[model samples]
Target: MIKRKKIYIEALRILAIFLVLFQHVPAFDYYLQDTSHVMGHLFFTLIAKINVPLFLMISGSLLLNREEGYREIFRKRMIKIILAILIFNFLVYLAENQFVFDLQDYCLGVFENGIDRSYWYLYSYLGFLVMMPLLHRIAQKMTKNDFILILFIHFVFSTIEPLLQWFVPTYLGQSFEFTWAFRIPFSTIKEIFYPLMGYYIDRKIHIESIHKKTLAGLGCLSLLGILISMFFTIWIGNQEGFSDEYLELFDYVSALSAFILIKSFFVHYEAVIPAWISQKIVLLGSVTYGVYLWDPFFRKLFFDGFDQFMIPWVGGFFSSVLWCICSFLVCGILVQFLKRIPKVKSLF
Candidate 1:
């Protein structure tokens, strides 16, 4: 028998995914152009950084059950993820043009640029999923030394490689061409690190002893990570000013650290956060994958002809936020409806 702490896990998952939705819209950064405006921008950025790491860590923690073999795992996750990606892609395509099945174009486009936008991550994760069996087999023999060695390889191949390319001489550039760049997204250092962390955290770290210190640790690191990330953006921004457009290297690292610490804190304090709240988190988290797949519809709404009528920051921000929230709701609705349809339900 297994313990199902559904609410606690789900709550965080929902928070994580919706926050990702918030990131794409004007909801967070439109207001944070300068220090004088509001702290909401920095808050959003901080959350954005931590969010994916939390999601990935949770995946590592939750999916490490060895009873499921490669075939079974692929059937359960890989196919579902792919189908979900296609569903959203189709929705977005339809919403964007009021027409469907532009097979020639879609095929050529996918073959060429590789699915566009966030879907790229899905493709990358597909690669990761394929490697899971090998990873699992190696996991049995894993040690702290092995873990640190993996981290060092990640640093050399993922983090340091990029830095060296930007600064170093001729030969330092070749590592960039390696295929892991396409598959792992910064070497999946966190993915590799977190599952191993989970194994130890579950087996070694005592819940009670960690409670107070975990809270303090998460708080401090979250603050520190945000400050360092913001400093990178601000220090660079003032010289040229920060654009809320996209993320950078330091942003990813700080965000990764902040989220890891935060998740650990949450696990440490699981008993304190009321039952209702945990249920909400679990519900949202479960539905989040569907929402992710359905996001392109909302994305279409953002780029719709509404642009002609309102291009102002306030208008754009509100409209984008509305679309994103509505998209989450719509995705949830569609998923529920899809479950009732026997044919559609079978696909996932």
Candidate 2:
């Protein structure tokens, strides 16, 4: 029997993709340099930074619950992503290189650096797919406390330590080597935490048991945390030449909280959403991968042609929102068209 798509999940996917598009807006650099709108840029960019975390959480929520074997995973999941990467990368390469076909240059670009840096997620996701079976097994066996413990460990090594290293004065710190001191090497496991956290929340948490007031308070705090982090990021960037270490760390924390809050809100009120709207959300969500692959092309096309005209009047933030909306719509339509072609459909 075929399963029904959860509207809340689709909503999350839509939000994630829009955030991805918004974050990639070319005007960010312009805003960053503009004294008048730097804070606004920082605020929006911080929110946009949640895109990857949200996507990973969605993946975790959907994939961890399944019991697919290695063969099934490779055939059903990995192959498609691999093909998408190759095909889209080549398309991007051709576009960037003016349709020049150089096998040697193309191969070097593919191996040394991606032809399109936006496709980094596809390669990372391919790695995630390779490890999904093992991850699923661990996730299935994990108790709530085990999940929490892993999250805590990741938080310490990944978030807390990094922040401390950045803020602490170098003169006051001493390096001491201990043979028995062991660390989980969170640098490698950082990306793994989001999916695991997603599975934990989706499968283990009973949202109904929690009070609405409590959830609201947590959500408010999460928003505040995101804002505070953005402010600090701006301040530090101005003072210390703009390293994203602190902001990126806080992003993981904030994104997790935001994901939970958004998921809870959708779960509680999803039924009230009009059926027509939900259908559109699902349709848009379904085409997100394709849209994502094609977004940069449209983004450049639109931004280059229209940004100068719009920015001076409506300002940077609003102009970016407008561009993002247009880019998403165009990319969505393009993806739908491509999906109809038998030879190209598999890439999406």
Candidate 3:
């Protein structure tokens, strides 16, 4: 028998999808470039950075505690993700082509990176799935303190060290490197860190705040992340011209805080939320996988023109927000229509 669904997981999934779409709403252009739009682009990109890690966290929260055997997990979960990559990548390829085939370009895209670069998450997530059993086993052996230490280590090596290396040379007139024995694995734990922490926080930590303090605190943390991102963008992005693509420590901390806050809120108040609203949230959440698959197509088809018109009228920020909302509505409807077919719907 299937286990009952968790409300917060669904809510978080919906939030993640919206943020993902928000990041994709074509905002930056030479014609639209201004201080406000540049600021908007920065804010949009910063918040949207949470989407992938949050998605992984959702998976960990729901699945890490499962009793299924590795074989079952591999067959049921890993295989499905692999199939999604193949199926969705094919659709992306077809959508990009106007009946003309470029075999060399197509092969390079599919083999080198992916059909659509955004689909790289699917591939990385496939690797995550393959490692889930090991991660689960490791997590089971870890205590709260141990996990906290892991997070600390991960932050220092993955985020702080990298940031220092990137910015220190400019400020200090020299590059700094750790002694050979003192060096840590820089980015090795990135994909696994948030997910493992998500499982730990969801299962082990029992949090409740009836006064909505958790949500308030998360809002504050998110704001702090924004400030940190702004500082870096103005300081480093200005100097470097925005080439580096590292997701910083503040982003992950803010994302984790928000993730925990939402989980706490839904856990404590799931019953108090109106059934209709809850059903709607869950319904949208159910189609997020499909939305992620089809959103780019709809964005190009519907929002491209809307963006050009709206960005000039309003600004990049609000235009993108409007585009994001339209994307959800259109993609939701599109997914619903596709779901009418039994076999085709399963691919999404």
Best by TM-score: 2
Residue-level error in angstroms, candidate 2, position 251 = 1.7
Query: How does each model score on lDDT?
Result: 0.58, 0.74, 0.72
Q: Write the per-residue lDDT of candidate 2 for residues 1-348, one digit (tens) a residue.
A: 111337667777888899888877765444456646777666666777779888887888789889899999999899998777777777777777767788888777777647777778888888788778877887788797887788777767756676566556545576533233657632236457778888878788876576888787877766776776766677777887654555565666667777667667767776776778777877888888888888765554456567789988997667878987887888889888988999877777
lDDT of 1 at 42: 64
Looking at model 3, residue 289 earns an lDDT score of 88
Model 1 lDDT on a 0 to 1 scale: 0.58
Q: What is the RMSD of candidate 1?
A: 5.3
Each candidate: RMSD to true structure?
5.3, 3.1, 3.5
| TM-scores, each model vs. reference | 0.74, 0.89, 0.86
lDDT of 3 by residue, 40-122 (tens): 56666677778888998887777777766779977877777778776666667767785366768776777776787777778
How big is the positional error of residue 307 in model 2, measured in Å on the Cα after superposition?
Answer: 2.7
lDDT for residue 1 in candidate 1, whole number 0-100: 15
Give the per-residue lDDT digits (tens) of candidate 1, residues 205-323: 45446556655675675566556556555655666666643333444444444444545556666767776666656656667776776675667665465444455644655665666
Where's the lowest-lDDT run of ten residues in candidate 1?
A: 1-10
| Clash numbers, per candidate | 7, 0, 0
Alpha-carbon runs more than 4 Å astray in model 1: 1-4, 27-40, 112-116, 145-204, 241-277, 302-323, 346-348
